[model samples]
Target: MDVPFDLNSYVRVLKLASTPSWEEFSRVALIAGAGVALVGLLGFVIFLLMSFVPGAGL
Candidate 1:
């Protein structure tokens, strides 16, 4: 049996994948952090609302 994944292809991918610059990395991190914070806030709001519901057992 022969394998389809060639070592040259892996080398090509490694060559193409470059490290993100500081500016690019920071911008992406800020966006991702904002997204996570927003989702967490939304979840917290939902939890508060659910806690107020009667007989829901929290």
Candidate 2:
């Protein structure tokens, strides 16, 4: 069996891709940061709750 690389397909994809404007980048960054902070807060809450469990061993 043999496989072939499609260079033209990759080139076409690259041509279609564009960098986000500053406003777009700022919105994306804010949303991503909030998501990460939310996840961290949730994990910390879970950890704090587990520490109170009688047999969790902290």
Q: What is the C-alpha RMSD of each candidate to the true structure, in Å?
A: 2.1, 2.4
Which residue runs of candidate 1 sit more than 4 Å off their true CA positions? 1-5, 55-58
lDDT of each: 0.89, 0.88
Q: Candidate 2: how many backbone clashes?
A: 0
Model 1 agreement with the true structure over 1-58: per-residue lDDT tens digits: 2345687778889999999999999999999999999999999998887889887644
Q: Tell me how far the alpha carbon of residue 16 in candidate 2 is from the true structure, in angstroms, after superposition.
A: 0.7
**In terms of TM-score, how similar is model 1 to the real structure?**
0.80
Looking at model 2, which ten-residue stretch has the lowest summed lDDT?
A: 1-10
Clashing pairs in 2: none
Look at candidate 1 and give me any clashing residue pairs. Answer: none
TM-score of 2: 0.83
Instruction: Give the 10-residue window scoring lowest on summed lDDT in candidate 1.
Output: 1-10
